[model samples]
Target: MEGLTAQAAIVEAPGGEFTLAAVTIDPPGPEQVRVAIHACGVCHTDMVMRDGGLPIPFPVVLGHEGAGVVEAVGSAVEGIAPGDHVLLSFHSCGRCTACGDHQPGYCDEFVPRNFLGARTVGEGDIRRDGSAVGGNIFGQSAFATSALAHADNVVPIDPALPLALLAPLGCGIQTGAGTVMETLRLQPGQSIAVFGGGAVGLAAVMAARILGASRIAVLDLHPARLDLARDLGATETADAIERLSGPFDHIVDTTGVPALVERAIDLLAPRGTLALVGAYPPGGAISIDPAAVMSVGRRVVGVVEGGIDPRRFIPRLIDHYRAGELPLEKLVRTYRFAEIERAFAASSEGSVVKPVLVMPAVS
Candidate 1:
């Protein structure tokens, strides 16, 4: 393989220390694939990992929304080869109940393994040398210039597409689309209230549109996001979703802020459903009015990666992107890899919807 001059962002300490440095990547072991990352979407979860929300191994590589080309593959890997374009998702054990059922997003061992940043394969831990660093962040420490991901988890893409856009498709977009289509199963004309018009919220808006929701309302405080929300397909835009008073048939909450979650529950109409698609810090909990939920026969559900099977979802996304539907281009704003900290700042401030950090081309 070409000389691997991989770069990575290291979380040396919680909230206070994020360091970008050169790192050496090892060759893929059995069943692993090495990917030369072209783009990685700066996701909130990565930031949370830096800020110590998920208690990952220190100096961990933190990114899950990465798209790139396969540079190498291990002996046991099949159906994937060098030069294949791929996107990585949250890790899963293939034999688990959820994974066997094609819902790896629901794998029972998902949280501990993916969050702890442990290796899904290989003899010993891979790191930046000497220090105890963890790889396998989501089974693909994709924040680096390259990553070694489990081959089974890599979804191939046509090289004709830009890796920059495909990055977000891995998690954010898939989660939003899958939540409405697979998890909630919105009938032809049911209403959906989408809370928090960030990347995921706006994505839900588009996905609900694709599902033909009768009424799709986007709720968020940011005017710009609301504008984007409307562009995506939200029939109505609301700054305060709770102002609607009665709940709609479904609520998709992208804001893990407990207060907003509580408000979402309040807005549910009888027999309404709520889906929490965002990440809350460890120990984060929302207070619920059990009687209110019971009286209305309401249900609150959690969705991970939009409850999607990435292999199927990614290809569908590619088709949608080519078909003039999905409208994903409107969601992304790109930045250079060196500007990742700036990109993260813009994302955290809600100044940009989805700030993708593009890597420099290798010679």
Candidate 2:
């Protein structure tokens, strides 16, 4: 069968710059769909992978937070059709026990399905110069004008909403909001301290406020991010956690810094929980006082993808946005496809909370 050729950003080596190139994408499989990507969000995870934080193979295409319109559907796909708008998320093996329990974040095949840079069953669906290329990073190598996505990993959204603005909801935004509303389950009138004022931290702040948290504190090194946090509903903002008194009902550490994790543990109130949602470097470790844990009845948990099913959670986030609660657009900044490097630079410098790459509209 004939293939579709499109523009994509490819990294040829660890810590290499992303270069634009023409790549060929095969037609959808029996259970896949083709998306004409409109926009994709720049994420810290992509940065990490680019810098060799993960053992990703070189010459790979890496992007996950994608939103676009359906171009075609596989013979077996259902409920999704051409002309529908959708957001792409992480992939999971539906047969795994974790996936059966609705916790695809912990799916047994997660590493193979999401981190391997190729689909589980096929050699790969992307090629360059008649050679195979990595395509299915997170089931949607969305740094291109088009991508092939599994039916299960695509979530339909309203076409009326800005596609570029909705891109981040697939990962970063959902991870933050879900950590606050789903993982920690912060109740109204409770307290929470988020130890980072970036996209994830600010998302938590919005969710905490929506849940009526009486006191929501945010700590970040950047004054601008702290100010943005305040505007996003943080009741307290500080340059350091030391400036904020905690003993909070819940403490969330979105910074993987070992020192910050220790401090977050110390700030948790008796019987309170500390949720860790940050990505740590390989083999990194943190020390905690075991006696304090026993005496205070504290709970420490590591959260993955906010412990939420994207199909259920993304819609709720959109609903919150519609209700004027999420205000996710405040954190977004758009860049043209050719400006992907500039977008990466802004994200690396902490200049933009979320940088979305907008592809040229396909006519």
Candidate 3:
């Protein structure tokens, strides 16, 4: 599949519309693999990249939560083969201290590896009209018919599972569940308050249930999303402005709002943990009461990708889904790859929970 032509959703400028157009994809470099993507999940992260929040160059292909089949493996890659089904997550340098310690999310080069437009170590592979376009937007750039992905970012999955439904396990789902299961390690009968009730928050709610948490509350402005959170194992739903006095063991702020963060910290119990997993715009800051934190021994921590290795954690998520414990399907809303603009609209309007873009059927 050398010199293959592919269609990708290209963002030409900040705030520009996504244009589905033909582009040239280079052969995989050594230690890379070429994937024929079956499905890609649209995330708020994609919107951030498109709107210049992370400041990558224009004309970039952006989609991180991707699931596909390996069509070509670079000579140096191993274990993964051309026919293997796979899910694409964030890229990390395997040799970093964080990676060596099994926390690739905290890799030293996270921003350069995933957010920067170019490949982490070499030249990018996407070209349009003979000029370079950002191809490695989270190492997969799977808003396309195919993507050139680093082998380190591609996690093989069971071929029997529906690739489309499993695409989101790469990011949003993993982040939420990982935050609850791995980061907080919420115990049975513990209490957790998850703010925002979006995909990440709902995933946390589901995870809290799986971990046997006794009190799980989800807050959101959208009544529908709060209801969905309740359906996904939230014990209670509340409005964003309605602050509850809580001695909660953990509070997760996925809203990324400074106000909500302050409230979440205020609600924490003695020795409680506050996990911040939301993405705020650059320069955003949250203020918490230092005296209270010191007095109560409250701990506030920022998390990335739920603080778990995707290779190990994603399979656990799949097992939860298979056992009907995760109920991730309740959060999905699918769209055609060509309908990415509409999908963005749906996401922005809060009309869909998690929009999955289905690529064109490969013959």
Candidate 4:
């Protein structure tokens, strides 16, 4: 399938618009798989990359939360083949110590492999007018009708599930739920406070509810999102963290606001854990008193991709969705692939909790 033509949304410069263009996809390498993307979730991280918040280069394709069907597989690929349904997540080097320890999210080569926007520093797999275009962001660069992904970043899933609905499990949903279920390991009858009522925070709320949390409080500035948080199993919703009283057994901060993280530290109960899943801006820092944290035995841990292996955690989330425990419908809003700009707008305005872009079907 070398030199296959596909439609892709490309960002030509920092803070530039997403222009739909004809690009050519290269054949998969020995450890790569090509996917025909069905749906891709618009995440805040995508916006960050677009606005040059990260170190990724320009003229890049950016979409990490993608779900699709396998279009082709490389010679060395196993357990995945053409015609399989799959979810695309971040890339990780399988030989890293973190991967060997079952924590691929912390893989040593995470930055270059996932954020460099190319297979290597200067080479990209997709081309437009014979010039290399950045295409391997998150190992998938899936803002296109089709994408080439590393075998390790592609997780085959049950075909019965709707790709549009399951797209977010690749990133946002997994980060939120994984932080609660795996990182903090929240126990039943415990109390939790989730800061920021966006998709990630709302997901944490739902996970806490699934764990039988005694009290779940969600803090967000938007009333609509706060209301949605309540419907998703939050026992309390407030526009500000100050409005909620807490000695919370666990707290998840998805806002990435340094102030909110500082406030969350004070809310934790003794020996309680506070998981930070939101991405802070480059060189961002927060001030905290060591005495306060140590005196209460509070723990502050940073999490990436929920500190989980997608192969193991994504399927579990799917099962929860199947059982009616994770009500994804309440959070997702679909847009046609051509409406990519509008989808990003909706996500930025908080009008949509999770915006999924559906690709046009192949003729």
Candidate 5:
């Protein structure tokens, strides 16, 4: 088989610069599959990697919000086959306690193994200079022409829907929805407050609506996004966080700023749960009112990748999008793969919501 040149947008180190470059992909060995990516989402995490929030080893592919077709399968893999449509999510070891408990995000060895960027498994998965590239970054690293993902991370998807639009379902969309659906599991007729109003926050808003929240309020610094929140399904929208004081049944803060997290908790009702899903800088911590927390019986929960298994959640999200209930397509701005630099710039400007990089045809 002829090898294909795989292009990956990678940052060489934590807090280092990044660029897109091509690399050669070897054939998949047993227990591995090579996916030709059709689309990869330029998520905030990509920016965070550039900013060094996540310590992904340099010279490693940085994308995880990915969807595409399986071009080749490893020998030992099962059920899923080549040509299967698939989406990739962050990686976790299945045998870990967290994975066993259905909390793979909290896998004990997940941080070092996934963030280090080389092939995660000791088995033959990646190769570079006769040395395997540390690849299992979140288990997928779906940013290249062909991503070598574990059978566990490469989830098969229905081929009926557009692949490009479905990429974000693995990360941001699932984050928000999972917070409500799996993490908080807020009951019906409850009230929820979603802060940020970007993709993650909007995802929370949409998920809350699906979960039947009676009162859903969205707060954002950007009025334009707040408007979109209203269009999406938010019962009320506010530009400033200070404008409202609430005892919300559930509060979701996708902003990592300490002050915002604190204020989000303040809005929570008695026995309310505050779900913080954003990435905070190293050594950063928030100060909450201990007295109020004790008196109000408030609890703060941190959500990672929206507390989900990609294989389980991506399908439901796709169904919601197909039905127009979770119309995530409306939030996306597609960019040609060649325009990746521009898309990254636009995402940073807060001008674009979800920027998807559509790979050119292989003709």
Candidate 6:
């Protein structure tokens, strides 16, 4: 296999605007596959990386929630072949203990592999004018029309489904829905309060409704999102967490706001659980009363990628979507790949829940 040229959205520096330019993509490594991306979802984490919230190298291509068709595979890859439809997820080292236990989200090399923008320091696969450009972000960096991904992060899916609609299942949707279905496992008749009625929170609302949760409350600053939350199965909606009466069986905080997290801990019912799914900047901290947690046996757990194996969980999510149980259409808005800036603006302004970039067809 030889290198291929593709157009990608690149950020030249911290807090930089994305520039669409032609770049050279390397062929698949022994344990990798190459994908011709059809669509990629814009996530808050992508904005976080853009604004220097993460310590990734610049001049990087960053898009993790991608869905596409496999174009090629390496010698060591199996079970996936050219023309297979697939969705990309976070990268994980298959040999790690967490991965051995089927929990790849907690892989030991997660930070270095997913955030550092390369497989190792100073080595990048994508290049421009012979200059190494940061790639391998989340192991796919599918912002490009093509991406190289680890075999572990690529899950083959049915070709009949719309890739644009299912793009977000790789990240935000999975995180939100998985937090409820896998992490908290909210039982029937239980109650849950989800903070931040964005894609993640709304996905949780849908999952909670599917699980038959008695009370599903969503809190968000935007009135429109709150209304959408109600329409998506949130039994209640509020602009502030305090306004919603709690003592809830489960609480999920997707805002990454320290103060809100602290407040949420106080509202957990006895022996209840709290799942933290948001990203906070490095060194972000919260003050918690140990006694408050100990007295009620409240549990707080940090979740990544909904604490799920995408290979398994993504298929289940597709099943729900097929049944019309998970209405992804309500949460997604598509844009042409060139409309990247407008997509970001829509996401930042809360005008769109999930903005998916549809790549131009290959000639």
Write candidate 2's Cα lDDT for 104-214 as tens digits: 888888887787874655423888999987768888899999998988889999999889998999999998999999989999999999988878888899999999999
Backbone clash pairs for candidate 5 read 12-58, 12-59, 13-58, 91-138, 117-134, 117-135, 118-134, 118-135, 119-134, 119-135
Each prediction's whole-model lDDT (CA):
0.82, 0.89, 0.89, 0.90, 0.79, 0.92
Decide which is better by TM-score, 1 or 6: 6
User: By lDDT, highest first, what's the ranking?
Assistant: 6, 4, 2, 3, 1, 5
Q: Give the candidate number with the greatest lDDT.
A: 6
lDDT of 5 by residue, 1-363 (tens): 545667666656666555666666777767777888899888888888766677766556667788889988877889789889888887776898788877777777778656766453434444444444546566677666677777877879888878888888878888988898899998999999888877898998899898899899998888788889988889998877887668799988887778888777678899999998887878997888898788979998888888887778777888888788899877899988778778888888888889998876654
Q: lDDT for model 3, on a 0 to 1 scale?
A: 0.89
- Writing each residue's lDDT as its tens digit, candidate 1 over 204-232 gives 88878887888899888899988888888
lDDT of 6: 0.92
Clashing pairs in 3: none
Screening candidate 6 with a backbone cut-off below 3 angstroms (N, C-alpha, C), the clashing residue pairs are none
What CA RMSD would candidate 6 show? 1.5
Give lDDT: candidate 6, residue 245. 94
For each candidate, what TM-score against the reference?
A: 0.94, 0.98, 0.98, 0.98, 0.94, 0.98
| lDDT for model 1 | 0.82
Candidate 1 ranges beyond 4 A from true positions: 1-3, 120-125, 129-132
Candidate 3 displacement at residue 44 in angstroms: 0.9
